[model samples]
Target: VNGQFVTDNGTNIFDIYKEELLKNPYTAENARIAASHYGSQLFDLAKNGFDSIPDLVLSISYQNGSLQDIGQKVNYGVKKTID
Candidate 1:
């Protein structure tokens, strides 16, 4: 999924993604991993200006009612100034 974050939007991308993860049953273990990874990335991005946010990629697989090697790729566009 592609998303954009603007300061005045009052919406946090990470929070929405975390909620989605919680709602998905097949994403138990990988969800935590993804959250941690993305959370760190977000922190880093926030620390240096919102520019240069990269695409997040992870490997994910579901087998026998279990998730294995879970991964996902998402791109986010952050606009520090809104017109």
Candidate 2:
């Protein structure tokens, strides 16, 4: 995929995640607790196993400034087959 498309998609994903975190009470609270519990998990995961990993999610940080402006885009598709 093109860089422009990836950037736009990444921004969209960020917006959606932020919106969901704001809208969902449980998510917001759990995220706060997770931040406290897993302070460096995101960075660790990123550094250790980013490309080799699959279906992993990392959150952006506001206070620590560690992952303030990071973004990515994943491209996949669904296939339907008849047996």
Candidate 3:
């Protein structure tokens, strides 16, 4: 775990893993997959302008005084006519 805090004997301590922190999460395959899924839509949005596109909202909440306990909610959608 990188940049994570661990509780030991009722004490919270920062745990840093250099190797995990330095690892790259993005890969060529991930890029290709993202492009395959949203390339056309993104291009269209750029060309048409994002005025009509709905705003994306993300909400994150945590509880139990634990970093492991987390929740997220996302709202995203777009409506456009392509002809």
Please identify which of the two predictions, 1 or 3, would achieve the higher lDDT against the true structure: 1
Superposed Cα deviation of residue 50, candidate 3 (Å): 1.2
- Model 3 CA deviation exceeding 4 Å by range: 1-25, 55-83
Summarize candidate 2's per-residue lDDT along 2-66 as a digit string, tens digits: 21112443653334554576578777867655554554554455456556567856645443323
In lDDT terms, which candidate is top? 1
Candidate 1, superposed: residue stretches over 4 Å from native:
1-9, 50-83
Please give, for residues 3-76, the per-residue lDDT of candidate 1 as tens digits: 44434567777788888987899876589898899878776676665567666675666555655444334322
Best TM-score goes to which candidate?
A: 1
lDDT of 3 by residue, 1-83 (tens): 12223455533231122223334474443655554455566556545676869887655444344332123333222332344
State residue 69's C-alpha deviation in candidate 2, in Å. 42
> Can you give the lDDT of residue 50 in candidate 2?
56
Ranking by TM-score: 1, 3, 2
